[model samples]
Target chain A: MTIKEKSEAIVEEFAIFDDWMDKYAHLIELGKELPIIDEKYKDESHLISGCQSRVWLHADYVNDNVVYTADSDAVITKGIISLLIRVMSDANPSEIYSSDFTFIDDIGLSTHLSPTRANGLVSMVKQMKLYAKALYLRAEK
Target chain B: MGFKINSIRNDFPVLSTKVNGKQLVYLDNGATTHKPMQVIDRISNYYMTENSNVHRASYNLSHIATDLFENSRKFIANFINAASYREIIFTKGTTESVNLVASGFSDIITEGDEIIITVMEHHSNFVPWQQLCKKNKATLRFLSVLKDGTIDLSELLAMINSKTKLISITHISNVLGTINPVKKISEIAHNNGVPVFVDGAQAIAHANVDVSEIDCDFYCFSGHKAYGPMGIGVLYGKEEWLNRLSPYQYGGEMISSVNFKSTTFNELPYKFEAGTPNVAGALGLERSLRYIQDIGLDNIFKYEDDLLQYATKKFENIKGVMIIGNAKSKIPVISLNIEGLHPYDIGILLDQMGIAIRTGNHCAQPLMEALELPGTLRVSMALYNTKEEIDLFADALMKAIDMLT
Candidate 1:
């Protein structure tokens, strides 16, 4: 399935269950389906601090577009990270910069996060974009 | 003997209430405690009858308000066994208190000075010192905790030297419940001419906190954690040191004179309180403190200690539930994880059963990383908690474990 189709399917599953307890299994399953990232990028430089669940994110700048690979220690957070990578990977720096992540609310899973956790999520995405922006800016320089 | 657990429950009316048809067994007291009726009445009465700005007013209402505000300061000084009322400086809460010290000392703490804190500190104690060190080009080092959750004393002693300027620490582990050996640590710092600051946020309610007994340079605690009002906290500095540190904020109350060209700050405690203080909250805090005093802190501590012992035994009986932080000295906080379940899921399940617990890292993310766990369900205790409540919590946990595992 296409990334959009899989994302839509994930979004649809969220609607099918209101209780987080009921949705937890599906969320863990989502994490299970995420492809293992290459061993080369799994290092300290890509580590995200302040997460109870460990998250490592790496971006490869191939031909001016960003390809993202991510993993998390917690199954549910990994799933969320996979969903994030699928939506964000391969997007151009300008497109990623201009895009609104209101898809968080659209998918109806934003409320499941605590305010601090939501802030951390925004921070994580911001960092990924920052990595892309810096790489693009360096190339330009 | 007159106070059965149920009878004592009247002091906390929130316990009797139902949330989503579940009885609220609030085990999250270490996070923030519920207010007693005396505290509630005192706060409401301040707003309703004696509402006025203090220290600068002379009206009848203002006189009463001013008197009450000063009385609260005295009450806090007495509560913490400070030498005099001048030692206590009121701020918004523990975070504000720490920020006050960090900001105030920034001028004096030169680039080479070293600041020490512990691993178990809430971000309040850790971050302010970190920012202070970062700003001044100094070093921020932590006293690591043992596998059993006690402070690594040898490591702490080795780290302290002539260059070490301050030792900031938490009195009790909000997550681990391990009571640090502050007195011994204080002795080491003092011998080396380094001052220590104890974050008494979690300890004030659980145990007796004597500034003189600990002999630390500074101590801070929030009122909310001790069954007092929110938005009010105290910073206790030794008279000599408090006299030396400059003001953190520049404003009306904290200063003696502010002319067009320059300004002079007030003496000691007033030098720290910058704005109009939380008068009502202070009044409420005093009442709550008086209530605790009347109940007897030693008695309360013994009772909770017993309850902790009982709860620990019961927790050990449960299968696949790993109880974290087995320090030799601990309060009633029980941090545990049921295998194969997220801490959030355990908290949600417990919430559904009417038990309130903190599910996340409990604001000590570094400790969580050190423990190599996502998070643990923290069931912290207060004076009012009973063994029966723990039994209820354990039964709920057993059910949660069944569902999750």
Candidate 2:
């Protein structure tokens, strides 16, 4: 699916929950079900240190598409990472680079995305886009 | 006068507010406190009526502003039992206050000179000395913390020698809530002919601080942490020490006379205060200190101690909940982590439940390293917080844990 389509689907899924409890519960479940990254890539080289939590993100260019895997010490942050991965992973680097990811605000989880929150999600998103942009430029070269 | 919890809570207008559709239960007083209407009104009144640059002009408004600002210095001196108001130098906050002293000491410290600090110090107290030592080719020693998060004075004594020029320690550990024996530390340092500096950022609001009684050569604290306005802090030093050190910043008010050739520095306090000062912030801080005085620090100490004990007992009952700092002498701050849960997760979940707490290293990374953990959730209480709020917090924590698990 396209990045926009995948984000819209997740937003629709979140819309069924009326209260914060249900929304958070869904995030927690998603966190538990996240595709675990390889133990080797969880080292300091991939580490993104936030004041509140730590995130490790690894991306690869394969079959002319970008594949992303990530992890966080905080489950909520990991859950948010899972959404970003769902929307951007397995897409072309140009498609991933151009994607806005405004779905975070649309789904009412914008607070977690704030730079002040310092959960590493904001930095992780930036790192992901940077990876895509670098790969796209390299391929063009 | 008796301690009136109801009226005290009412004084803080933010207490009545709600968050996330639930009544707000603010337990993050360690970070910064909610200002009372008294302090708020004082600040607003200063900006409203008495807005002028102090110590500059001979105009009526400037004189009024100068008087108010100088009176605040006097009030703070009395509040901390300093020898004189001239010993109190105003700065932006505790960070700047510590940096100011550190900057002055850079000239005094030479190669192989030693400076000792505790592992439990906040970064504000830690980084300045570290960088100073690094720059000057001096030695920086850290006094280790015991398992109970208390400092071992014997270690401190062993670390001090003729080579040791200074000992900088926190009066209270911002992360561990360990209240050090400042008087004893000061005595130890003085006996060894070394000057001691106390970071009283956490202690000034929670406990009674008598700088003369402590006898430390230098002490500092932030006003925001003590229920006052931000951007205002106090640095109290011995008259001899203040005279011995060079000025940290060179600017307008800090000079007696200036020319292209050279300039003469101002007197004790103003020498350290360089720029146009935060006059309104100083006034607000003085007013907040008065508010604390009216409530009585003894009463605040007793009230907060009871609350800490109550919360500790409640937290101890929960399985897998580990209280990080187990010091016998602690203020109303508690750091804890549940088994198999990250502090960030707990902090986020608690916020959704309309509870505010502090998580992460609490800006004491060395202490966190010593404790061998990522971070712990901290709940710091103030006089305005009540038993009911604690009960609510306990319930919300359990619910958060349940949901996470």
Best by DockQ: 2
Q: What tens digits encode model 2's per-residue C-alpha lDDT throughout B235-314? A: 99999999999999999799999999999999989999998999999999999999989998899999999999999999
Per-residue lDDT over B168-237 for candidate 1, one digit per residue giving the tens place of the 0 to 100 score: 9999999999999899889999999998889889988888799899998899899999889999989999
lDDT of 1: 0.83
Worst 10-residue lDDT window, candidate 1 chain B = B1-10
| Model 1: pairs clashing at backbone N, Cα or C within 3 Å | none
Q: What is the DockQ of each candidate?
A: 0.16, 0.66
Poorest 10 consecutive residues by lDDT, candidate 2 chain B: B343-352
lDDT digits (tens) for residues A1-141 of candidate 2: 899999999999999999887898899899988998999999999887553677888998888898999888888878888989999999999888888888888898876433556445567778999988887778779
TM-score (chain B) of candidate 1: 0.97
Q: If scored against the real structure, what TM-score would every candidate get?
A: 0.83, 0.97
**How would you encode candidate 1's per-residue C-alpha lDDT over A18-86 as one tens digit per residue?**
765566556667777888777777788878876655678888889888888887756667777777887
Docking class of 1: incorrect
